[model samples]
Target: MSQVRPGARRVLGATAVESPVIQPRLRTIPEATVARLAVYLRVLAGFADGGRTTVSSGELASAAGVNPAGLRKDLSHLGSCGVRGVGYDVRALRERIARVLGAEQSRACVLVGLGNLGTALADYAGFGSRGFRFTGLFDAAPDRVGQRIGGLPVQPMTELEATVTGTGVSIGVIATPAEVAQQICDRLTAAGVRSILNFAPMTLTAPAGVDVRQVDLSVELQVLAFLGQQRAVPAGEVPA
Candidate 1:
């Protein structure tokens, strides 16, 4: 008698048996859809907190600041279809969206640089409530080091690698000056951080598999100024 392994065809005398081949398809969700899902989840949470059990597409769309059809289309990605004359179950929808967004798991985050912007982010109370826990804060300045901000003592940048490894931080925030932003990013990536939130004026580049999001307040303000100037200009007037 010949022994048969799982998924391998077994031969007995003149007969052979084969296992069925199963191929799984990977589902790819659009980045824009994922962002809108977060907004929808928040709106759903508010509804649930208000003792609402169900929400119509139009109502949810209005609350989420999107069109009803577009909201329905987004929800379709989750394979959720509302019943006739009834809307989605608020609590269920919220839980589904949260699961898809990985909001159920808390991620450790480390902050580098203790400048004004960094300090403001450290003091923000929304991080904890939104599944982000600050595990470490670092600064290059000797004076800033050893000082406490937002209940966490600021460590020297020299301790960044150790702190990140010890805390299992997956996300790093760079608030350093433009000159040192890339250096800090490299350090963070080398320390095993794959996601970064950058507030520095200069753009920071990361190696493959690392995600970096930059928030430039100056650029945002300049965009607003440009729009203001456009509005100020008359239909036929050309500014020299």
Candidate 2:
């Protein structure tokens, strides 16, 4: 079969064609490892665009900001054995990682909160352009509710439970204020949401089996400040 270049096809290692769903035989690979596979896939695609046909484990690690040994170990779980001296086939590895990450299949997402950030996220072209489709947007404010943002209807928060339950929304983007984030999270969890991409600046407690990933603007700014301060310090000024 002729494979379409730049399409959603996966190439595992040198010759294996794999699907995104984890098979019973490959259940040993951790979910964290699976997440990183997508990161690696994006890096490899960059290399492929640069005319590189092959990449070593060390090279892939450097590009993806991971250790070579760890990268190799993760790839090994996918049955990707790097050639002893030839390294890995870049195209093959890229496809395999995409397959494992389900890049070919789009996942639906719901966004809650119609604040500035939420509005921007609702309008974000990256999500839909990628494999994440946003089918619902919600907010608690009556004035904002029933409005349309980013081509998605901003429904009232009262409908969150039903919309999520009916849509089988596995992923949620929480853009609500810190005060209401946990409450929203609880509702989402109770409504069967399993994964959350949290932009609220508060710690949310969820029961087992729920995955919550936080994106804190202040935290990122602080890290950037730390890096800037480190650069300003003298190399040998440790006399404190």
Off by over 4 Å in 1: 1-26, 234-240
* Regions more than 4 Å wrong, model 2: 1-35, 48-53, 65-70, 81-87, 230-240
Clash count of each predicted structure: 0, 1
Task: Tell how far residue 210 is off in model 1, in angstroms.
Answer: 1.2
Q: For model 1, what is the error of residue 131's alpha carbon versus the real structure, in angstroms, after optimal superposition? A: 1.1
Give the Cα RMSD of candidate 2. 9.0
RMSD of each: 12.7, 9.0
**Best model per TM-score:** 1
Query: Model 1 over residues 58-173: C-alpha lDDT tens digits?
Result: 99999988899998988887675577689898878887888777887898999998899899999998787667889999999999998999999999888999999998999999
lDDT of each: 0.81, 0.80
